[model samples]
Target chain A: MVDWIAAFSMPLIQNMFIVAAIACVLCGVVGTLVVVKRMVFVTGGIAHTTFGGVGMAYYLMSVFAVSWFTPMIGAAVFAVVSAVIMALPAVSRRMREDSVIGVLWSVGMALGVIFMSLMDRSVVTPRSFESILFGDILLVGNTELKIIAVVTIISLIVIATLFRDLQALTFDETHAKLSGINVTVMNVILYVIIAMTCVVALNVVGIVMVIALITIPAAMSNMFTESLKEMMIVSVILSLIMAFFGLIISIGVDIPPGATVSVTMGVLFVVAIVVKTAFGKITQGKME
Target chain B: MIPIEIKDLSAGYDGRAVFSNVNLELRDRDFLAVIGPNGGGKTTLFKVILGLINPMSGTVKVFGEEPVVSARKIGYVPQNENLDSEYPISAREVVLMGMRSKKGIRPFYSKEDKEAAERAMEYAEVIDFADSRISKLSGGQRQRVYLARALAPEPKILMLDEPTASLDPSMKDCTYDILRKLNKDGVAIMLITHDMSSISHDVKRVACMNHRLIVNDAPEITQEMIALGFHCVPELVHIGSCDCGGHNHG
Candidate 1:
């Protein structure tokens, strides 16, 4: 088994493991903000919008030579901008928030489809498009792994430095504002971090399942912990473990890693819920 | 000294006005309970004071400075509207957030800050539930936790929007008693309440507000005053009855 594991020929598969590990760690850190702010839907909105950026990059690459990092950077910037717009009217008018999110989600998906359709068929292959949709782990290179590592480290540092402020904003905005914290600034910072996570996870999980990878682990961890710090730690551990297991299984079965990872997270969430319910009932019985 | 002064303040939402040409002065240590009908703009007026919403035209001054400029000096307890009850945060953590707006990016809480939070919890009578999750608390306990969170900043002026709404009679009394005690301790309070009869005896003054302001001098409310304050519209008066059982409306 050790010799077989060593015999794995593809360098891209090693890079894929490195990239997935980095992405999972980053998701664990930044996903806490998305969960605490109740911005799970907003993160979904941003993830969907990133497809438009991907389409734009693909179309532009046909005419102008573009590096691999260009599309990811473009997608990250677009996602952050979309997050800012979502936060604006949503924060001001309480009633129109959901409607605004829905409209933005539809617009983003529509823009992605339109841009993809406009691209020349000869330059942008259907298989390449399929790779973008479901993610191709075998395509991850050393450069992608490096980028993910830098992003994960920076995001973790920022989150650590601003953890208290984020906690305050998450628990109570008005109270945070009254204490002299600029609630708007904190919210914008959070969205930017979330956008970065979306961009990083896009390569690993694809657009459709990025939100699940970001939210599900956090939600599952919530069943076991009370403190935000504990929730974040548990969430990261859960995400990494799930990612490792999913990658191994995908390699064995020759299946898509993103779908496997998402399914693993979903299973974990269901198990968490059931176990939490049973434990709660046992505690109640003991109390009686 | 008057911590808050509203001079000829006429405020409302959209294009229509709720209260117009209103004048009020809240001195330090004044626990002014704003008792009026349901659609009377009491909460709107407080929102205007808090700078959450701008008044169509009027001046609101806190400590002789604009309300927006001196936001730190004032704390607010908003009505419990759509707060996810199942959110996993402790009561102490909630109260600690009150200091976050002032602390900014300090990244660490000082001994003084922790003590202030503890004192606020004690003042709000929720110190016992400090480690408990907010979702686990009862309505009365949750209300106190929110109050503790607001008071954690040690603001000179505290504004509440319907603090007693949907609470039991005993809970309402307990909340009011705590407010009365805070007022005595020199924190000027502006409470927007629908429970007029219960709060009328405790408050020093009352203002009847609807589409416009009608500042009344009398301590006790009368049926005639309710008629004039609500613009004598039978439909508007009918809506007021559903709020607190026609206590202030006769």
Candidate 2:
């Protein structure tokens, strides 16, 4: 037992824990906004569209020998830009929002596949695609953990400073606009924040399950709290617990941490819904 | 002084004109009721005044400034349109939003703001439900709460779209009583409704609209005018005698 614990205490495992904790915090905070604003679909759209950025980064990496951060930066930029474009008045007017998201999703997948086909034949490996799909938690080095820490801290500060504005905007957009809150600007800022969260969380939850990480905990928290601030705190705690449990389970069973985290969150969500309903029925029965 | 003035205003949606070349003026303390048919442009006119949509070619001013620039002096009550009642918001919080529009980024409501909101709630008779969740209120009660929210801003002009649309007879009377009192308190009221007969007794002026300003007259709707303006013969319509009991219309 002591030998196993020592083996798990390596720098790689420590780095993974730190990076996962930061990603969980960031997703929990921003996920509350996404749930309240009914932007789960938009977050899904950005998540899928990030593949285009990955493709762009891969194509440029061979030519310029850029670092690993280049892909994440490209993904963040594309996600934010695509989100803003979809939200533009003209695009929203010309096409239904869901249809626009569908178009972007297909285009992004196509671009990613084409770029993969064009990659150097010798470098073609199953693990490279696996990293994009399921993520490689073992790759979270100290530098990656530091980057995640900085992003998580900045996100926390920004959300705290604009808490009131975000609350007002989420509850009622017209009222927020009338209050001179610049609803458009605030919405853009929120999209940018969500985009950054998507990029950061992609490393932990992977691209396919990013929205699940961003939505499940928040949805679970909503069943218990009415206040937005309280919901956010509860969601953050729940996500952190899930992340820790996922890491432990993955270490014990040799399963992927992302899959473990998502499955745990799903089970928690179902359990929360059942408990809430049972409690509600019990209270009503007692009142009667 | 006139708080709102529209001249040669033509507005529409999707390139199809709803109304054209409509001219109107709204003076201070004036309660003007815009009565029109289903496809008429009553709501469109209000949207235009609120600067939500632009007229194809015309000019509109609120308090001698463009309606968009002078939004501070105007409070709007949209029709009892379908709102997601499941949204967790209290009635007091809804009214507080009115004050927020006027006092942006103040961090806290002033004493004067609270007093004004309380007074508005009293006027709308929604004080009892101030702490209640908005979703729990009935249609009439919710309308009153919305009115209180509009009045919280203490605007010189208040515009409502079909405030009595879905109410029963008793609820309609109660709503009109509140509106009449608000009008008496010198808050200019602009109501858009299809229930012309219901509001004819309370408002002094009625503007009949179709694709244009058909008529902007005092509460003197005659059977002949209804026939001409609506292009339909009345079915057992009763034209009442005026308040002075001297001018009766048939």
Candidate 3:
């Protein structure tokens, strides 16, 4: 335990812990809306689709030899664009939602692969792709931590200010509209928030694992809570616990932190579902 | 004063009209029931009046202005299919949504907002399940909660689209009775539904729309109006012993 305390003193572990806490809290709040709004597939699409921007940033950095260029900017831009593209068809009622999402999902990945292959071979490397897919949480830098913190604050402020409008919009959009809430504008803002969240959480969990972080904990919370407030509270708590446990286990077993974090949350999610189902059955039997 | 008025309104999707050449006027003390066949542009008319969709041509005024401008004075209950039952909200919380328009910059609900929500819940007879999960409630209970949500804003006019679609007979009767009481309290109501039996006695006026608007002060439904409303008038059913057919002397 003394060694464990000392180990946490290292800046790298400390950064990992800080990022985990921030990401969990952010996911907890945002995830509740995502699940309740049924934006799981859309969010997943945004996450995967951001790779297009990642590939663009990589190709540009190599071509221009600009050390200042980073994938973070690329991810932000691509995420927003992808979200808008995905949201347009659904909002307009012109196309079926699933088909549009499916198309964007594959097109995004394909565009990323194309951009990567088009890059200069000498600059492109296999290790770079691995870092994007499976994040190296042990290497989280101060810059990344700052970015996450800023995003977390922004997310909190926006969600807090729009809490009432969001509640109405999510529950009954027609009523919200009649109540003078701008449904279209609010929807765009929500998608943008989701995009920014995806970009901020990308470094902590990587593109593949970020959706799980946002969705699983919220879904777990939904199994028990009755109100959106309670769901958010419980989800945030669950995210922090999962993140802490995953971080500790990664340190102990010498495994990749990102994969372990997602796996830990996933296993716990399954366990929660089973327990809730069993408990529900027993209670229902008694009532009958 | 007229709370809702539409003149020569033509609205639809993809530039194709769902309703055309429509006209209507709703008075403050009016309890109007809009009944027609499925896909007869009933919901579209409500959307136009609610400012969800723009009219292709013609003018619409809600409370003597653009519908969006006076939206705060209007309470709307959409089809229950539009409200997801799986949402994580309590019955009271659902009602509190009515106060959202009034909560401009305040992050939290005020004492007055809470009081209004409580009163609305009480009026809707859903105070007992104020804390219960909305999804766990039965169909009738959920309907009551939604009605309370609409009433929480204290709107001058209430517009409901098919509030009794899936309810049992007794539940349907209960819902109609509540609407009648609200109407008696001088709240203007615009109800769009297919079940003419339950609402014919409660409403003061009747309208039928199938791309065109037909309004009548009496509860009687004429065969000419039915022919124009349903495009064929296959068979007319009498509602409330008021012969709904063969009244050509309009």
Best by TM-score: 3
Candidate 1 CAPRI category: acceptable
lDDT of 2 at A235: 87
Model 2 global lDDT (CA atoms, 0 to 1): 0.77
Q: How many pairs collide in each candidate, listed in order?
A: 7, 0, 0
TM-score of each: 0.89, 0.87, 0.91
lDDT, candidate 2, A64-176, per-residue tens: 45546356766776788878877676887678889988887788767777766665545423237677766777776666677778877888888888776777778767556
Better of 1 and 2 by TM-score: 1
Clash pairs, candidate 2, are none
Residue-by-residue lDDT tens digits, candidate 2, B197-238? 555667877777777775545765655446535775322223
DockQ ranking from best candidate downward:
3, 1, 2
- Please identify model 2 stretches exceeding 4 Å from their true place: A1-10, A121-127, B106-119, B127-132, B168-170, B195-197, B220-250
Task: State the lDDT of candidate 1 residue by residue for A91-116, as single tens digits.
Answer: 54655666666776778777767766
Please give the TM-score that candidate 2 achieves against the real structure.
0.87
Model 3 misses residue B191 by how many Å? 0.5
Cα error, residue A77 of model 2, in Å, equals 1.2
- Model 3 regions more than 4 Å off: A1-9, A88-93, A120-127, B103-105, B229-250
List the candidate 1 regions with Cα displacement exceeding 4 Å: A1-4, A7-10, A89-95, A117-127, B216-219, B228-250
Write candidate 3's Cα lDDT for A1-288 as tens digits: 237978889888888889889888999999998999999988888888888888887788777765565677788888898888765635548777777777877887788888788877687442377778777776667887888899889988999999888887777777777777777788888888888888877777888888988998999999999889899999999999998999898889888888889999999999999999999999889978
Please, what's the RMSD in Å of model 3? 5.9
